[model samples]
Target: MKRLYHWPLDPAGRLVRLALGERGEAFETLESPPWSPHPDISRLAHGAVAPAIVDLKTEPRMFACGTRAICEHLAETGDGTALLPESAADRAEARRLWAWVEAACEEVTDTLLTERVMQWVRRDRQPDSARLRRGAHALRGRLTFMNGMVEINGYLAGRQVSLADLAAAAHLSAYDYFGDVEWDAVPDLKEWYARLKSRPSFRPLLADRLKAVRPVAHYADLDF
Candidate 1:
C-alpha cells in the first residue's frame, strides 16, 4: 500500500489528505509533527516531513513531499477526479494558482499558525505575540486580496474547484480553529469555505482536536 507520513494539524498535510480523499485513493496515515527533530517517520524515505510518501513495493520507497507535487502525483497514479487538467493552458493555470497559494500559506498562513496555534504544540520558550500580531495583520491583508480574487465567479483558482481551493481552505481551516479568521469580513469566501468544510473528507479535519484549543461552534456548523 502507498503510505503517507503526515501530521493531522498541518495545513499542508490537510491539503494533501483532502485531495487524496476527494480522488478516492487509499493510503496509510502517520502523524509526524514538522518541528520535531527526533528520529520519526520511516528510514526508507530518509526524511521526516509531514507529507513524505512511500510506496513499499518500490526499490526506493521514497516518493515525494510538498503539497502541490504530491497532489499531482496522486491524481496521476489513481482513478477518478482528474486534479491536473488535461490542457496545457489549464495545467499552466492550475500550477500558477498552486504556486501562489503555497507562497501565501508559507509567508502568511504558517506564520500565524506557528504563533497562535502551534505554540502550544512545542515546549518552546514562548509564543512571539508581536509576530503573531504581525501575522494576523498579514492575514487580513492577504484575505482582502484573496477575497477579491475569489469574488470574480467564486473559487480561488477560477471557476472550477482545484488545488487552489484545497490550499486556501486548508490554511483558513487551521486559522478558523484558532478563531483567527474574521468570516464576516469575507462573506463570499466564508460561504465558499462553509461548503468545502461540509464535505465528508473535510469533516475529519474540522473534528480534529488539539489540547488547549477549543474550536467555535461555527467551525463544524455547515451553515454560516
Candidate 2:
C-alpha cells in the first residue's frame, strides 16, 4: 500500500495528483496538515510537506517530497507517462514551458488564493487588500503572454497535452473555484480549459470542496 500525506486544497499537491492520474496510479491519500510544525514539517526536518508519499514496497516508513521528484518517480515505476519528453529538443521545450508557468502561475494564483481562499482556511494571517490587488493586477500581464501561446497553439506547452498543461490547469482551477478567472479575455485558454476540465481525473479536482469556502457552480461544470 502506498500513502500520500496531502492537503486537499493545495495547488502544489494537486500537481502530484494530476501526475498520479496521468500514470493511472492508485495510492491512499492522508490529510496531513501542519498540526504541529515542530516535528513533521520541513522546517522541522521530519516528514516532507503536504503530498509526501510513502511506498510500502520499498520504504514504507520513509517519505518523499517535492512535486517533480514524486511525479518523476511514479512515471519511472508506473505506466511510464510521456510527461517529460525523451527528445532533447522536446524535453528542453517542455522544461522551459513548465518553468514559465511555475514562475508566474503559482505566485499569481496564490496571491488571489491567499487573499480570498487560504485566508479563510487559516484565520491568523489577515488578508492584505493592497498586496492582493497588486498581485491580481500584475497577474493579468501573464494572461497576455498565455493568451498568445493559447492562440498560436492548442496547448500550453505545445500541440499535445503535457505536464505544462497540468501545471497551469492546477493553478488556474483554484481560481476558477472562486470565480476569479476572466474567461472572456482568453477564448483559446477557455477552450483548452474546457477540454482539460472535461477529463475524468479533472472531475475529482473540480468537485473538491473546502469547508471554509464553497466553489462556484461553474467551477465544476466541465463544459465551462
**Candidate 1: misplaced stretches above 4 Å?**
37-42, 45-48, 57-62, 123-125
User: Which residues of candidate 2, in runs, are more than 4 Å off?
Assistant: 34-47, 60-62
Clashing pairs in 2: none
**Taking the tens digit of each residue's C-alpha lDDT, what string does model 1 give over 137-201?**
88898788778878885777667777778888888888787788999998788878877887777
Worst 10 residues of 2 by lDDT: 36-45
For each candidate, the alpha-carbon lDDT, in order, equals: 0.75, 0.73
Q: What are the RMSDs of all candidates, in order?
A: 2.3, 2.6
Each prediction's TM-score versus the true structure? 0.88, 0.87
Q: What TM-score, to 2 decimals, does candidate 1 have? A: 0.88
lDDT per residue (tens digit) for residues 1-224 in model 2: 66676766667777777777777767777676544322344632354566677776773264568677776676556673576766778767777887788788766755777677547767667888886887677667777677788777787767777777787888788767778788888888888889888866676687688887788888888767
